[model samples]
Target: MSAIDNLPPLREVIATHQLSARKSLGQNFLLDLNLTAKIARQAGDLAACDVLEIGPGPGGLTRGLLSEGARKVVAIEKDTRCIAALQDIAAAYPGRLQIINGDALEIDPLQHLTPPVRIAANLPYNVGTELLVRWLTPPDWPPFWQSLTLMFQREVAERIVAQPGGKAYGRLAILAQWRCEARIAMSLPPEAFTPPPKVSSAVVHLTALPEPRYPADAATLSRVVAAAFNQRRKMLRASLKGMAPDIEDRLIAAGIKPTDRAEQISLEGFCALARELRRP
Candidate 1:
C-alpha cells in the first residue's frame, strides 16, 4: 500500500498496466505517492472542492486528490491505456472518483463537475500553456473554477508569476495577473518522474479574484497585450502604430511611455492602455 492510501505503488500499477511515458502525449508519470500527495496539498483545502485533473497518467495525482479528502474528483485522460488503472483508483474511493476517457481540450468538464471547483493537474507539457490560457481568458469574470493548482515546466511556471522587466514576463504574465492572484507553490526536480524529464517542473497556484485587479474589456486587453508582445522587441509606438493613428497620445494618456517595450510594461499599464484604446 502507498503511504497516502491503500492503492498499490504507482510503479507497480504502471508495470501491471504496461504504461510508459509517451513523449508525443507529454506524459511523465510522478510515481511517488508521497510526492503526489504533496502536490495535491498545494491546492489548499479539497474537502469542499471538486477537482478537475488533466493527464492523470497511471492515477498518481488522481490518487493524491482522493486521499487528500477532495469532495469529488473528475479526471480527464486522453490516453486510453490509463483508464483501467484509473478504474482501480475509482473502485478504491467508490463514488468520489469519475474517470473520463477523452482529450482534455475537447471535453467540457463542467458537465461532470459541480460548483466550488478547483483544477489541479500535472498537465501534459505539450498543451499546458494552451489549457492555462483558456482557463484564464474565459468569457466572464469569476470563472467556473475557484482556483488552479497546476504543474508546468519551470520556465512556464515562471511566466505565470513573473513581474514586468524580466524576459519571462509578457502576454502570459499580463493575462494571468490581470484577473487572478498567482504564485509558484512548489518546485520538483527532473529526477522526480518515472522517466525523468530534461528540465525541472514547478506548480503554480492561482486563485480567482472576485473582480479583475484593474478593469478593462477582456477582448480589448487580450488584443492589446497580444499585439504588444507579438512584437516585443519594438517600441510601443512602433509596435502599436496600427492600433490607432493617435497611438502615442493614447499611450501618454494611459501613463505609459511610447518609447517603452512590451516586457517593460506592468499589468496595470497594459490595462490602462486597453481602456484608452477602447475610447473613441
Candidate 2:
C-alpha cells in the first residue's frame, strides 16, 4: 500500500494498468506518495477547499490531495489508459474523488466544483502555460478559484514571479503579478518523476487579491504588455509606435522614458501606459 492510502504504490498501479508516460501528452508521472503529499500541502488548508487537478497519471497527487484533507478533488485526465487507475483512487476515497476522462482544455471544471475552490496540479507540460493564461485572464476581476498551486518547468515558474529588468520578465509576470500574490513555493529535481524530464520543476503558489494592484483596463493592459514584450529588445518608442502616433509623448506622460525597453519597465509602468493609451 502507498504511504498515504490503501491503494497500491504508483509503480505497481502503473504496471498493472500498463501505463507509460506519453510524450505527446506531456506526461511525467510523479511516483512518490510522500512527495506528492508535500506538493499538496503547498496549496494551504485544502481541508475546506474543493481542488481541481490536471493530468493525474497513476493518481499520485490525487491521493495526496485526498489524504491531505481536501474536501473534494475533481481530477481531469486526458489519457484513457489512466482512467482505470484513477477509478481505483475514486473507489478508495469514495465520493471524495471525481475522475473525468477528457481534455482539460475543452472541459469547464467550474460546473463540478463548489465555491472556495482551489486548483492544484502537476500539470502536463504541453498545455501548462496555456492553462495558466486561461485562469489568469478571465473576464472578471476576482476569478472563480481562490488560489492556484501548480507545477511547471523551473524556467516557466521563474517567469511567473520574475521581477522587471530580467529576460524572464514578460507578459506572464505582468499578468500574474497584477492581481495575484505569486511565489515559488517548492522545487523538485528532474529525478523525482517516473521518467524524469530534462529540466527541473517547481510549484508556484498564487493567491488572488480582491482587485488588481493598480487600476487599468484588463484588455488594454494585456495589449500594451503583449506589444511591449513581443519585441522586447526594441525601445518603447520604436516598439509601441504602432500603438499610437504620439506614442513617445504617451510614454513620457506615463512616467516612462521613450528609449527604455520592455524588460526595464515595471508592471505599474505598463498599467500607467495602458491608462494613457485608453485616453481620448
The clash count of every prediction, one per candidate, is: 0, 0
TM-score of each: 0.99, 0.99
lDDT of each: 0.94, 0.95
Give the least accurate 10-residue stretch of model 2, judged by summed lDDT: 1-10
RMSD in angstroms between candidate 1 and the native structure over all alpha carbons: 0.6
For model 1, which pairs clash? none
Residue-wise lDDT of candidate 1 within 1-280, one digit each (tens)? 7899887899899999999889999999999999999999999999998999999989999999999999999999999999999999999999999999999999999999998999999999999999999999998889999999999999999999999998999889988999899999999999999789999999999999999999899999999988999999999999999889999999999999999999999899999999999999
lDDT of 1: 0.94
Across 169-239, the per-residue lDDT of candidate 2 in tens digits comes to 99999999999999999999999997999999999999999999999999999999999999999999999
